[model samples]
Target: MGLTQRALPDTPVGPDAFVLGRRRLRSGFRRSDTSRFCDDVWRLAPVLHQRQQASLILNFPAIPARFRPAVKVLFYALLNNKPPAGERQLGVVTIHGYFQAFKEFLDWLDPQHHDRFSSLTPVDLCQFQKHLLATVSSAKQRANHRRSVRLLWTWREHLADDHIPVDPDRLEDDWNEDNSRARRRENANPRIPEQVISPLVVWSLRFVDDFADDILAAQDEWLALQKKTRRDSHSGHGARRRLAALMRRYQADRRPLPGGTEGQHGINIRHLAREVDCDRQSLMAPASWGLIEQAREDVGVDDSTYLRTEIRGLLDGEPWLKRISYDEDLVVLVRILTAAAYTLIAYLSGMRDSEVKHIRRGCLTTDADRTGKITRRKIISMAFKGEGTPLGVEATWVVGRPVARAVEVLDRLQPKRQRWLFAVPPSSHSHKAPRTTEAKTTKATNNDLNLMVTWINDYCRQHGRTDHIPDVSRRPWRLSTAQFRRTLAWFIGRRPGGSIAGAIQYRHLSIQMFEGYAGTSKSGFRAEAQQEALLARGEGLSLMVDRHEHERLRGPSADEARVRLDKFGDRVRFLGKTPDDNQMKKLMERNDPRIYPGRFVTCTDNPNRRLCRLPGEKDMNPDPGQCKPLTCRNVALTDSNAQAWLQRLAELDARLQASDALAPRVRVRLEEDRAEIQAFLTRAGVLEPADAST
Candidate 1:
C-alpha cells in the first residue's frame, strides 16, 4: 500500500496525502475509489482536523473495532495536515470528540452477548435507545449522545471507501442500514418547531430610547447611588432600597409636564428625533406604532405619539409595570417598559425565548461577570439561550437609567420563588383557583399587543360598550398575535425603497436562531400569518356585506353576485385558499333555517307548537314555554322569505340611488346598510321589509 506509483502529481492533496492515500487503498484499495475518496476526505480534512478531540476519536469504535483504528488514523492524518500553529483547533477537537462518543455505544454492544460481528439486532438497538433515553440523566445529554453516533458512522464510511482493505458494502450495511442509526437520526434531529423570541428586548429598548436623556441621567445617578450605598450585590436588602430610590427619581424625571408637550406622553419629540436619527416629520408621520385613535375625531396625534405617550407612561414608575393592576397613565408606562426590555435584549445580547421566559427575580445585575453564573451563584444567572445551559452576558445595558427604572418596577412586582419578570395575573376561571406564587404561575407568552387588545375588548364588553367590540364579528374581540410582533419587526426592518415594508431588522440574529425547526424558516411564521389573514378576510366580508345588503337582496339583478364575487374574490383569495371561503359559506348556509319560523301565527287548538302557512311550506316552531327558548327558531326572515323580500330591498335601493334630497353620505350609508342587513337576514333565515318608519 505504501508503494506510490502515481501519474497525476498536480492533484490537490493535503500534507498527509501519502499516509491517507495508502490507508484509503488498504481499506478498499480500488484505484478510482481510492483517488476520489482520498481527495474528498483530504479536502474536507481541514474542517474535520479543526474538530479533533479524544472523545470524538473514541466514538469511532462504535463502528466495530475492525473499522475504528482505520477511522481514528484518518482523523489523525486529517489533523496532522493542519498548518503548524496559527490554525483553529475547534474543528479538530469537535471531530475527535464526536468519534470518541461511539466507544460508549460500542461498549454497550458486548460481542459476548450476540457476536455476529458484534452486531446488535434491531430489537437490541431499540433496547439500547430505550436504555439511553431511560438512563441518561438529561434530555440534552441523550440528544448529544445520539448526535455523536451519527458522526461516527459518517467518519467510518470516510475510512472504508478506499486505500484500507475492508468490505465497504458490509460495513455500510452494519452502520447506515441498521435500526440504531435510524433511531439515532430521529433523536439527533428532533422535529420540534422553533418558538418565536419574546418581544421583551425590542419593547424594552424602545421604552428606554423614548426617555433617552432622563434614562441616561438616571442610570448614572443609580450607579453612583449603588457605589455610595456599598450595595453592589443584587441580592442584599440595602441593594434593593438603593435601587428603589433610584427608580423613584428616574420615574419623577420621566413624567410629562402637564400641558407641556404637543406629541403624546411626555416624550420630548425634539429629544426622540435626535436619538432615533429620524426627522421630526418622520417621527410624527402616519405609521403603525402610533395610537389608532378612531374615537377622537378632532385629535391629531399620530400612532407614534400615541405609542410614545403610552409607553413612556408605563415605564415611568417601577421596573415591572403590571397592565392589569395599573390605571390608564400607568398602563402606558408598563407598555414602554415591555417594549424597551425587548429591544435591549435583542440588540445588546442575543438572548432567546427560553432565556426571556426564565428571566426572573435576581436574574439581572450590574456587576461584571468574572465567571459564568450558575443557578447556585448569587450573581445574575441567565437561562441558557441554546438549551438549559446557563449563560452570562456582562452587565452593560443594566447600568442604563431606563433599565434601572424598569428593573425597579419589575423587582417590586416580582413574585416570591421563580416569579417571571413579565408575569401577567391569571384570568378568572370557574374550574381553577388563581395561582399567585411565582413558582405556581406561568407568564403570558402570546404577543403583548394582542393580549392588550383582548384585555381592552373584554373590558369594553363587560362595561356595556358597543363600538369597542366590532359589531361585524360573530364572536367579537378576536386577536391577531402574529401581526403584533411581525409588524414591529417589519416596521423596524422596513427598507427605504420597498413598496410595503422590508423587515431587515434583527438580521444579527442568525437564521438558525430564528428558525422554528432546522430546515423550514418560514413554516411557523407562514402558519401564523394564514390564521390572522383568514380572520381579517372574515372581518372584511362582514363589513362589505353590511354596506351592500339591500343591493344584494334585490334579486341578483344584472349579475350582481358575480360582480361582487369578482371584486372581493381576488382579495379573499389573496388571504389563502378560496376553498376555505366555500367551506365558510357552506357552514353559514347549514346553520341558516330556510323558513320563517318566527313569523308563524299561534294556533289556539295546538298551544304546544306554532303553525306558519306561508307560500307552500308547512313548518313547526315548538314553544318550550320560555319566551327566549332555544327551540323557538322563529328568526324574522328565512331564505324562503327572501324572494318575497327582494322587491322591497330593490325598491329601497332604487330610492337611495335616485335621491337628490338625502345627504350623499346618508344615501351611500343607506345603500350599504341595506346590503349588509339583507346578507345578515339571509344568513339568519330572516327576510322582512325595512321598518315602516325608515
Candidate 2:
C-alpha cells in the first residue's frame, strides 16, 4: 500500500487543487480566492455554517522564518492524506484545534532550541513536557500537546529536514498519556442541575406550548401596526380622527398607550406622533397635545400603569407573565421562544450544536397508521462529526412529540425566509433590517439559554411564585449548549424506568438513543447510558461494601454473596480516599459477574439455574422483573428483604380476614403463598416459626 500511494510534492500545490480535509469543497466557494488559500488559510465546506472558517485560517508567517517548511509539510499531510497506522482521517474542525496544540509546542520550542526536529533530543523533549505542565492548566490538555509532538515522529519520513529525533511514545514517565485517557473517559461539561433543568424545561415547554400562539399573534399585530404607521406618516391632515380611532381601540382592550417617561401610563407626544400621521414637533404642539391628553384620560390611564396585550400567558394554571406587549417584549419573547425550541430539541433529541443549527425548514417527519394517528416522529438533520463530506450525511433522530411541537413553533416564529430553526432571530419588532442567515453560534445560544433562566427567575419573583429555576451553589447554574445533550445522556442512563420531564420515559429514551439516536455514537448514547448504569451500580455496591451490609444477607446464596462482595471490596479499596472515574471504571469493568443486586434479592448468578432466563437466552445478566426469589437457587436476600416478606404476609392475612368473603379456592391459594414465604424465611433464619403464624 505504501509503495502504490502517491505523496504530495515539496513544492506547494495551487490553493484550488481540491482542499483535502473535507469530503468536498463547497459549491459556492470561489476557486479563484487563492491569496487566503496560499496563506494556508484552510477552508472546509461547512456542514452547517462557515463559523469554523475563522479558526481554519492559519497564519504560517507567525512561525519562526526557518521551521515553516516542516510545519507546513506536516499540516499538508494531515489535511490531504489518510493518516498512518490505520488512524481515521482528521476532520476540518479537528485539524483546526490540532494546530493550536502544535502552536504551543512551537512557541516554547523555537525560541531557544534546535532549528530542526532531528536536532531535538531527549532532554529538550523533557523540558518541552515541563513547559506544557507550566502552561496548560489541565493534565488532559498537556497530554494533547505531547500527542502533536508525537505526530512529528510519526510523519518523520516526509519531514526530511525536520523529523523529530526522539520517539515521543517512549516518554511515558514524563507525560503519563495512559492516565489521561482513562481519567477523561467522560465529558468535561457539567450537567445541568436538577433544579435548573426542571423549571428551565417546564418554562421552556410553557413558552412553546402555551405562550407561542400569543407571542406570534402579538408579533403579527405589531408588524401590521408598523406598516400602517409608515403609510399614515404623511397623513397629518386626518391626525385627529386617527388619534380618536387609536384611543377607542386602546379603551376597548383596556390597555393604556405606550407610556412616556413623564408619568405612569401617560401618553407620549412622540408615541402619538408615530401612532397618527404627524411629526413629533406637530404632535407636541398645542393642537395634538389637546387630543392626546383627552384620549389618555378617556382611556382611564390614571387607574394603572400596566399595558398588557390582549393575549394572556399562564402562571400556576393562570397567566405566567404580567403582560405581553407589542414592542421589545415581543422581540424578547421571540428570542425566548427560539431558546425554548433549542432547549427542547437539544435536550430531548441529543443532536449536537452543529446538527441542531443545520435543522432547516421542513425537517420534521412522521409516520401514522391507517387510523390517522401518528406513530413515530423523527427529525431529519445532518451529522457533521464523522462525515468527511462537505455537506454532512443526513441523519434522523426519533424524537418525541415535544420535539415535534417545538419544531412547529420555531417554524411559526422564524423570520420570513429564515431557513434554519435557530437562525439569528429578528432584533426589533419591525424586523425590517436584514440579519445574517446563520444559526445562533454556540456562544450566542449559550447566552440565550442562561438568559432564559434569568427571565424565568425574574418572572417567578414578580409573581410571588416559589418554583423558579434555582441556584446551583450560591448562584444560578451556568448553562451551555454542550451541557444539554451530555446531561440528557446521564439522565437517561440512570433513570431507566422514570420519566424525564413529565411525559417521556427514560427507558424508552435509552432504547431510542441506543438504536436511532447515536448522534455521535453511530451509538455514543448506548455506550454513555451503559456507563451511567455501571456508575450507578458501582455507587450502590460501594455503599453496601463500605457499610458491611452484605454480612446480614440471608438466602440460598448468602455464602456466595459474602465471598464475592469481599473480593470486590478488597480489590477496589482506595487509600482512605474517594475513587475517581478511572478507578471506578477499572472496578466496574473487572468486578465479579456473579453478584447482581435487586430490591428484593441479589442474584449470585448461576445461569444454568436462572429462573428469569428465556428458553434459549444466554445473556450474562438475569432479568430482575421476572425474578422468582423463593425458588431460584441464585437468590440471596439482604436484611431489608425479610421486612418486605413480613409486610406481604400481613397484607395477605388482612385480605383473608375480609368480611366480603373470599371463595374457598382463593383462601386456599392465599394460605399456600403465606406458607411458602414462611418456609423460605425459616430456612434463611430471618423469621421465627412463631412469628410466621399469619
Candidate 3:
C-alpha cells in the first residue's frame, strides 16, 4: 500500500502555471474507477452563474456528486437554453424549488440504484413519481415536485450532447394528469367591516382634535429635553464637577455627604439620577469612578433638589405636562400621536403601504389657482412601483384638510435631520447600529399599525369608553396593511351618497382618486373595486333568486324575473357552488336579465331599446345612474321601485303644498312632475286610475 503512491511534479504551481500537466494531473487525480465517470460536470459551472444558483451549487455538492452526468446536463440545459417565445427566464425562487426537488429525488434513488442517472430507464422515473405521491400529502406540494421533475426530464431530453437518457414525448404524455388542486378564493383581503371603521374613524378624529394641544405640548417637551441633554453634555462641566465632588466625598466617608441631610442638603438618589448625564443604573455602576473624579473638580453643592423643585413647579403650572417626565408615559403618548397621524393619512389618502412608508418630510404641498387662493392640497411622493420608469411617474394624492394636518403633526415628530415622515427609533437588538434618523420599513409599519389597534382597544377598556373598533366573527380584527385601501374602496363603491362628515363630496366619487391608489400594481384598486362589485352583484342575485322562489317577486318584471331565475337554477346545478366570471357571462348573455337592485330596476339589455345615455353607440354597457327605467321598453319595475315612486310622489305633494304662493309657471311645472309620478305608479299597478286623479 505504501509503494502505490503517485509521483509529484518538479515545478511549483504558480498562478500562470499549467497545473494540469501530465505529472501533476496524475498526482492530483482520484485513482478510483468512478472518478472520471462524470468529470464533465464541472463544465456546467458557467450555466449556474447567478449568485444564488452558484451559491446553491457550491453549497449542495452532494447533489451534483451523487446524480453525476444527469444533474450536470440539466444545469447546462437550463442555463444555456433559451426559453420558448413567450416564456420568461425562471425566477430564482422557482429555480431554488427545482433544485430542492432534484436533491430529494437523488436521496431516494441513491440506495435503490448504483447506476448513474443517465442510465436510469423510464420505469425508474415512474417509481419516483409514485414515491412522491405516496409520501407528499399536500396536493400543491405534489404538484410542485411533479413540475420540477418534468422540467428536469425535459431539459435532459433537449441537451445537444445526449448525455442523459430520457424520452421527452413519453415523459410528457405520462405526466399529463393534473396535480394542481389549489383553489383561489375570491375577495381574499379581509376588509375592516363598516361597523369597525365608523367608530375607529370617529375616535381617531376625536383623539387628534380634542387632544391636539396635549400632544403638541408633549412633543415640544420631548424636543426641549433632547436639546437640553445636548446642551448639558457640552456646557455642564461645572455642574458635573460639583456632582463628582459630592459622589467622591460620599465614597470616601462611606456615608451620605453633608449639606441638606434630613431637611438639609442630602441628595436623593432618584433626583441625582434624573439630573445627571447618565441613567440611574449607570450612575450607580462601579465604573462611575471616572465620572465622580470629573464631577469633583468643579466644587459646588449638588443642585438636584433645586432642579427637581423647579421641574415640579413647571408641571404644576401646566397640568398637561405632569406625566411628560415619565419615560414610559412619554413613549406611549408619542406612539398614540403617531398612530393617529398614520390612520388619517392611510385611510384618507388611500396610499399603499409601500407608498405610505416612502412619504418624506414636506410631502404635503398646497396648489394655488390663478387667483393665488389655495385651491387643492396634494401629497407629492415617490411611487416605488414605477421605480424603473422615466420621471414624472411619481404619485400625487389630492388630500383634504385633515390629511394635511396629519402630515404636519408627523413632520414635527422627527428631528430636522430625519427626512422620513414616519421615521421611528431603531430596535435595541437590530443588527445595524442605532441612528437618530431611521425610517419605518414596510413590515415595521404594518406591525406598528397592529400595535396601534391593540393600544386603542386597551385604552378603551381602561377608560370604559363605549366607542371602540369591533371584531369580525369571533377573532380580534387583525388589521392588515391592505385593509386600509380595500375598506376605503368598499365604502366608495357601495355607498357613493353615504355621509362622512355631512355631505358626499366629488373627491370621493372621482375615478382618478382610485386610479392613484390602484396604479401601483397591475391588479390594485381597480381589481379590488371590480371584485367588490362582483361580490355585491352575486349577493343581490342570490337574494333575488331566493325571493323569486318564494313567489315574492310581484312586479312588472316578475314573469321575466321568474324565467331568468329558473335558467340560473339550471346552470347552478352544472356549474357547482360558485360559477366563474366566464360561466356567469355565458349564463347572462341570452335576454341579459341584469338587475339593478340599488336603483330598483331590472334591465333586459336590448341594445336597440336601451335608454342609458352614459354608454356610447357601439358600447352595450349600461349606467345605473342614468337609467331611465320608467320610459324604456326594456325596463321592469319591482315592488321596491313602486314604493320608491310613491315616496317621491308624497315628497312632491308636500313641496307643492308648501309653495302655494309660487308663480303660475312654477305651479304648472310642479303639476307636470306630479302627473308623471302618478302615471308611472298607475302603470305599475301600485295606484288606481282614481288614485292618479287624486
What is the lDDT of every predicted structure here?
0.36, 0.71, 0.55
| TM-scores of the candidates in the order shown | 0.29, 0.83, 0.64
In the range 60-145, model 1's lDDT, one tens digit per residue, is 32456444444444454444444224333324334455555545655676554543322444455545556676677755555455
Residue 195 local lDDT, model 3: 69
Query: Candidate 2 residues 1-694, lDDT tens each?
Result: 1211222345354443544533454554454542222344454433224431322455666666566656766777777766788466766666666778888788887778577778888888888888777777887678778877888888766676568777876877765555676656557677887767877887888889989887877776655555544344555557766777777777777666676554325555455565665556656556656766776776654322232455676656776555655444767777888899999999888888877887889999989999999988888887766565645678888888888999998888776587876776554533454433356678777878887888888877887879788887798888888888778877875664443466767666656656565543352556666676777677777788899999988889988888888887877685366677556766778774457776667788877888889757866578877899999988888877777877887898889787259888888899899899889888888887786653
lDDT of 3 by residue, 1-694 (tens): 0111111122122222211121111122332321111233222222221111122232245563445434544543454355544444553335656767777877887888545545667777777777877898865566567666666545544433433367433665344334232222233456787667676666556546555556556556544434333223432445455457656655664432222332223434444444444444444444553554343344444423221111221221443233333234455556666667777777777776656766788888887989999877778765543343311146777777777888887776666776877777321124155432235555555666667667778866876756667777877777666688777766665554455533435345336455545544332555556555655565456556656631444445556666776666666557666655444534555423455565556664556667775345635456667777667765666667667778888888987997868888898898898997788667767789999988
Query: Stretches of candidate 3 above 4 Å error?
Result: 1-86, 89-187, 193-217, 227-325, 332-350, 365-377, 382-393, 398-405, 425-439, 471-473, 491-512, 515-523, 549-562, 576-592, 660-668
Pairs with steric clashes in candidate 2? 23-388, 313-319, 313-320, 314-318, 314-319, 314-320, 315-318, 315-319, 315-320, 521-524
User: RMSD of each candidate?
Assistant: 23.9, 5.3, 11.3
Question: What ordering of candidates by TM-score runs from best to worst?
Answer: 2, 3, 1
Worst 10 residues of 3 by lDDT: 1-10
lDDT of 3: 0.55
Winner on TM-score between 2 and 3 is 2
